[model samples]
Target: MRNASIHPRTLGYLGRALSLEYSAVQQYMTQAALAEAWGLRDAADRFRHETVEEMQHAERLIKRMLGLGVAPNASQLRPAGLAYGLVELLLQDAALEAEIVALYDEATNFCRRIADTENAEFFNALLQDELQHAAEIETWLESLGVARRTTEDERAYF
Candidate 1:
């Protein structure tokens, strides 16, 4: 039986969030392996760390869904992004982080508009985490002398 506590729109948000988090996990894990293949140990290590971070996010989302009396379902998972160079990989990751942050921001606003304080707080916390991740990607890009990328149509809207 479906729980009546969560708004349907919020449920959609939660599902999409889970999908995006898994997408991040897949992307990062693949990048880590690629980095290792290319003998970029440092890059590989960083990607591995990112993979763990994203997995934790996915787990948290799953637990929240379970607590809400819903069977968690991530309807779609995007393919892992592949790149021949470390810079290219980081650029893709930066774009992905931006997309995730945007989704969480929208979700938070929607929950707030519906006066769902608990869900609003949930989305807001995730938003903050993603924002920090994005900022870190930006800083890494800056340190590498590669300016942040401007991508059109990069967002995989769920």
Candidate 2:
């Protein structure tokens, strides 16, 4: 692909994605430290793993932006969602994963609509990964007896 011109909206989506991914990395890293301080070593390790995964996602987004000849700037990163307990952190993570899933899904659809197979495939991969992460979190919640189908006003666990 020589001298390619990426659509502005697509760039917007990519930037938004990079921001969310980096935010997730921050969230998970903070949660990991919190868990460690609380003496939940296993939970801390799990969050650390999540941090790495989210970091990988951000890296991929940066690479994609560069491939499209754009500066890889994650526009804004949200504050890390913090909680005192492991379950609370997991709940926050589940909600974040839901948001990521929606973003990737929408981005993938937009790319497909514009007949950009490469970008569509990229977004779809991220979508699949986030979906799996969401499912794992849901299962973890279930295992801990904290899983509940959320009400209309609540963030969904599924």
Candidate 3:
């Protein structure tokens, strides 16, 4: 293992990513419960599975930080308060995934610009998963028609 000191900015980025992963785990678990309450069995199962995946991502980042002699930090994680409706919950999750995609893409691009191929690859893999999650959520939302109805209702009410 190269004892090369990871750049401070890179470490900061990784720390934030770790925090995000932790937050994702929490959010997915919560979503799973909400889905179950709403009688969305398949969606509940999917969220539960996603929670596990998020934990795995957190573990991977923790290992990488340990290897680089840095302590993983979770202080930057944002809290997701209670979601009211099913549509609200799903849209919140989708938005979170979108944010994650943006963050991962930025981190990977930074790594590539600095010639850090390994880190770049890691971020790219995570980004790909985030994008897939976003797309899946979008598809689910379309099928639910909640977003369309919300928009139409808002326009009519306003």
Top candidate when judged by lDDT against the true structure: 1
Instruction: Give the whole-model CA lDDT for all candidates, comma-separated.
Output: 0.88, 0.88, 0.80
Question: Candidate 1, residues 1-158: lDDT per residue as tens digits?
Answer: 67797899999999999999999999999999999999999989998999999999999899989988898999899999777898898888887888898889899999999999999999999888888788788788888899865555433321
TM-score of each: 0.92, 0.91, 0.86
- Over the stretch 6-45, how does candidate 3's per-residue lDDT look in tens digits? 6677887888889889999999998898889988898889
In candidate 3, where is summed lDDT lowest over 10 consecutive residues?
149-158
**Tens-digit lDDT string for candidate 2 (1-158):** 42355778889999999999999999999999999999999988998999999999999998888888888889799999777687888898888888898899889999999998999999999999998998889898988999656545334324
Clash count of each predicted structure: 0, 0, 0
lDDT of 2: 0.88
Choose the strongest candidate by TM-score.
1
What value does the lDDT take at residue 16 in candidate 3? 86
Candidate 2 wrong stretches, greater than 4 Å:
1-4, 150-158
Q: Candidate 3: give its CA RMSD in angstroms.
A: 5.9
The candidates, ranked best first by TM-score, are 1, 2, 3
Error of 3 at 88 (Å): 0.8
